[model samples]
Target: MVFKRRHKEKLIEATLFWIGSLTIIILILICLFLFRDALTLFSTHSFYSFVTGSLWYPTADPPLYGLIPLLLGSVLVTFGAICISVPLGITSAIYISEIASPRVASFLKPFIEILAGIPSVVYGFFGLVVLAPYLQLWLDLSTGQVALTGSVMLAVMALPTIISISEDAISSIPSSIREGSLAMGATNWQTIYKVVLPAALSGISAAVMLGMGRAIGETMTVMMVTGNAAVIPGMPEGIVESVRTMTATIALEMGEVPIGSEHYHALFAVGSVLFIMTFLINLAADIIKKKYRFKLEGS
Candidate 1:
């Protein structure tokens, strides 16, 4: 019996190892594919001009392909979405996981699940039809289809991911930790804020990273609502101004461009930039998580 159990364990371990290895292989293939097409974009255009120039006209005579404004747009919208989602998502998770009754949490979860399951196109439509008009009237912008509009819509889309994961992280903290804090005369809020949150910081960081990744890669909703104008606005308040993101740019223009044309290659290059940005963002989050976890454990 002992031998049979050991054999079964080895088989399960081998199966899991191969599945993980296959995923690594798939990721390597995807990187190769992206860089392969991306290199062609720089064959004719100077890499400096492609990155530094402010214009993004792909159809004009001697068409220019600057990435600064698109990057800015992506940054602004993502920053705004993070600002909106993090507070609300983390707060809701705290309420659901720690404060709320099981019935209340159950009632809330289906709505979140429904929201998450809705297609991006439907969110796009909602942004276009419902949110756009309200922003236009309330903020008095020239048009409602701007970075702010896209940011809000993306925040809504990211909320389910953030909240669900964070709640799980908080709920998974051992009951002994809570009991210890309570025995030390900590108030409920103090225990939650001081002990539980620190214990779950790594998971919260992961949740935030995933939510940010989702916001940054969103295409349909951003394209439909962000006005798709590839120019940096003049003022800081221009976060409310029309802008375009890299993902939206690729989605909007990739279909009609001729195969192997400069435009086509350029779009692939944009995708590569997006891939790098996501990698860097997650890397930074991971570093922070490690530092925070070390501090908590040491204390």
Candidate 2:
């Protein structure tokens, strides 16, 4: 019986290891596919022109394929999204983890989870039909679909991820730590602000990175709301202006682009860029998670 149990455990371990390896294999396959398709675009255009040139007119005679405006648009909306989500998500997590009564936490947690579960299409529709008009009226914009509108929708989508992870991190801190802080005569607010928050700072940062990744890669909502105009903003408030992100550019044009054409390959190249951006973000999250896991364990 002892030998049989040990055999079973070994088999389970090997099975789990193979499953994890499959995920890496899948990621490699995807990157290779994107690179294969993107090579056609690279053969004709200089790397600097592809990345730095401002124009994106793919249908004009001898079409230009600069990624600068799309990259800037993506950065603008993502920055705005992070600005909105991080503070509110962290605050709400703190409230739920430390301050809220059990009943309140239970009630609020479900709603936040529901927000994450909602389909991206639904969010896009809501932004288009409801939020857009309000934003145009409030900001005095010519149209409702602008970078700020996309940012608002993405911030909503990213909030649940940030809140869930941050709350988990704060809750994972041993209760004894809280007790020790209180025993030192610290006020409840002071204990949370100085003790709990600092302890969970790494995890909170990981949560923010993950949320930012989600916001940056989001396609439908950004496409529907960001006016689909590929242009670089000139001012700080230019984030409120109409713009189009890389994801939106791919989603908007990939269908009509003929196969084997430069336009089609360029769209694939854009997707490759988006893939690399998300890959870097997930890598950062992984590093932070491993670092903090060990740090917390050692502490």
Candidate 3:
């Protein structure tokens, strides 16, 4: 009986170990596959011009690969989305975590989760049909599809992630801290603002970082609404004009490229840029979180 039990335990341990190893190996293989063309971008002289210059005529005979225009479009739209999402998302989360009744929170939480589950393409279509037209009417722009419209759509999409993370952070705050603040004659709002928020600052920062990641990576909605022009105009002028993003550039052109063409590798180069950007954002978030945690511990 002892031998049988020992055998079973060994078998399970071995199986779990192999499963974890295989998963890591598979992930590495996938990363390599996706990043293979990143190397070619470095080898080409056009790489600098592609990344730094504004011209992006990929289909031109010599295929100008300047990525600045696309990069700018992405930044503008993401910045707008972050502006819309961050405050609203954080406030909503605070309300749910610190203020709302249990019954109300229980009901609302699922609704927010449902919003996250909605498909990106659905969001894109919604932007195309509804938000775009509304923006055009309000701004009196010639075209409804623009960077602002894409930003609005991305904002809506990022809300779920932001709200969910912020809520969790606020909820994780110790009830004792709230009680102590109240004992000090602080109002509920004061307790939340002066005590709770500072304590959960790391988590809130993480939530914002996560939302920014989502805004940056969102493709379909931006593709549908951004008008897909590749011009490097100033922010004020570009806001009114059409624009393209890195994700949209790759999505739009990848299919038409011959399999082994420079264009194909260029798409991978864009992917590498995106990957690096996300990685750096996540790293920054981590550093912020650790610093905040240390501050809390010291206090």
The most accurate candidate by TM-score is: 2
TM-score, per-candidate, Cα-based: 0.95, 0.95, 0.93
Superposed by TM-score, candidate 2 places the C-alpha of residue 151 at a distance from the truth, in angstroms, of 0.6
Residue 32, model 1: lDDT of 98
How does candidate 1 score on lDDT?
0.93
Which candidate would rank higher by TM-score, 1 or 2?
Answer: 2
lDDT (10s digit) by residue, model 2, range 1-299: 99999999999999999999999999899889899999778888777799888999998898999999999999999999999999999999999999999999999999999999999999999999999999999989899998889989999999999999999999988899999999999999999998888789788989999999999999999999889888887678777789999999998898898898999999998988888899899898888878877876788
Cα RMSD to the true fold for all candidates: 1.6, 1.6, 1.9
Kindly indicate the candidate among 2 and 3 with the higher TM-score: 2
User: Which ranges in model 1 have alpha carbons more than 4 Å from their true place?
Assistant: 1-10
Ranking the candidates on TM-score from highest down gives 2, 1, 3
Candidate 1, residues 1-299, lDDT tens digits: the string is 99999999999999999999999999999999999998998989899998898999999899989998889899899989999999999999999999999999999988898989999999999999999999999998899999999999999999999999899889999999999999999999999999999899888988899999999999999999999999976567878889999999999999999989999999998899999999998998799789888987898
Ranking by lDDT: 1, 2, 3
Give the number of the best model, judged by lDDT.
1
Q: Residue 13 CA error for candidate 3 (Å)?
A: 4.8
Q: Which 10 residues in a row give candidate 2 its minimum summed lDDT?
A: 231-240
